[model samples]
Target: MQGLIISALIAIGVIVLLGMTIRIVPQRNVYVVERLGKYRTSLEAGMHILMPFIDKVAYKHSLKEIVRDVPRQSCITKDNIEVSIDGVMYLQVIDPKSASYGVDDYVMAAQQLAQTTLRSVIGKIDLDKTFEERSEINMEVVQAVDEAAQPWGVKVLRYEVADINLPASIKDAMEKQVRAERERRAVVAESEGDRQAAINRSEGDRQAAINRSEGEKQEMINISEGEKMKQINEAEGRARQIELIAQATATGLREVATAVKEDGGEEAVSLRIAEQYVSAFEKLAKESTTLLLPSNLSDVGGTVAGLQKVLKTIDRTQP
Candidate 1:
């Protein structure tokens, strides 16, 4: 009975020792081992054997990337404006041993460092630039924190400013400024439209005036041309009438000359001259209401002789 109990106790002790010696670490995780309260080695993701009661896992660190939120804090800009800012930081533990021993708390240190760097970056620029240069500020924070975290086995990949809070007064002022600028632009646009409309109206008036002047000029030209044509036609008609009158007078004179050469022409001409002389005396007596007599009223033959001589001279001169 005593020997059976001793074998059973040995088997139970062996099982407890094996259970204490063997360790299995998960993937992407590192275990920092310490021997007798001093850091010995860092165990990777695999099965590890350690002497029982001698080696212990001091710290466990994940190699995976982590995201940490930086607490919101108030900062003053170069333009003397107070603004609240907050961000997120991407970090990874590169060395488990250093991460465990180099710093009291690397995560808290990184967060505090990021806050300080962000404040510093914000203080260097004005309020307007703070809103516009957020990426630059984030990059600067990452650079500053990453440099400071080297000994702590923390790698800061990047930083991003998540939110920026501005005062209500400042927001209202900005809105007013934008509204005023828009109103000024609208006024300028309306003025430009009015100016363009005035120019168009003036141009139209000028064109219309020109067209009216052209029409007037054309009308004057037509009138003048018509007057010239009328004058020419009148002159031509006058000339044609004068020509017809001259031709009728010439034909009458020719017929009289031909009749004078016909039978008994001398007797007929002498009688006609005597009759014209008597008719002239009668007309003078009636118009003057006085007695008018020839120097020799009985010398009718002498007057006839004078008229025949005048007629003979005319016939010789006419062709």
Candidate 2:
């Protein structure tokens, strides 16, 4: 019974020894070893052996990137505007020994430094710039925090400004100003459209008036040309009729003069004169019921002889 208890006690001691000496570090993890309360070595991934009860794990650090959110804090700008600011920070531990011995807590130090740096940067610019230049603010904060965190083996990758809140009164004022600007632009655009439309209408009216004038001028010219042709044709027709009448009268007079020069022309003229005188009496009797007889109406031969004598007298006078 004493031998069995000694064996079991020895086995239990071996197990405890193995547990203290051997260590299996996870991926992307580091274990810092201490000897006599001083840093001895740093353990990487996989299995590591240590001096039992002399060498122990002191600090554990993660090599992976870590993110921490910056708490919201009230900040004053250069323009004396109060705003609430919050952000996030990306960090990585580069050296485990420095991360352990350089600062009490690297993450807490980096985060606190980031908050103070953000306040300082925000106080330098105007409130409007804080909203517009967020990326610049973030970059400034990252640079400042990273530089100060170098001694703590904490590398700051980047910082981002999450939100910047403005007061309600300022928001309302900005909204009113934007609405007024939009209204002014709309009014100007409408005026420009009206001006353009009026110009188009005036141009159309001017063109229509010009076309009407051209048409009226063309119509006047056509009417004047037609009148001119009509007057010319009428004048030509009157001239043709007058010429024909004058020619016919001249031909009849020539025929009468030629007949007068022929033989028996005097006797024929006398007989024709007597017949015309009798015919004139007959025409007057038919027009009226009363007839005026000559004093020697039954002496026809005497009248005929008297006309012959008058014809002989006219013949003797001719050349």
Give the Cα lDDT of each candidate.
0.92, 0.90
User: What digit string (tens of lDDT, one per residue) describes model 1 on residues 18-47?
Assistant: 987988999999999999999999999999
Worst 10 residues of 1 by lDDT: 252-261
* Per-residue lDDT over 103-148 for candidate 2, one digit per residue giving the tens place of the 0 to 100 score: 9989889889999999999999997788789989999999999999
Each candidate's TM vs. the true structure? 0.61, 0.64
Error of 1 at 226 (Å): 13
Best by TM-score: 2
Highest lDDT among the candidates is held by which one?
A: 1
lDDT of 2: 0.90
Lowest-sum lDDT 10-residue window in model 2: 252-261
Q: What's the TM for model 2?
A: 0.64
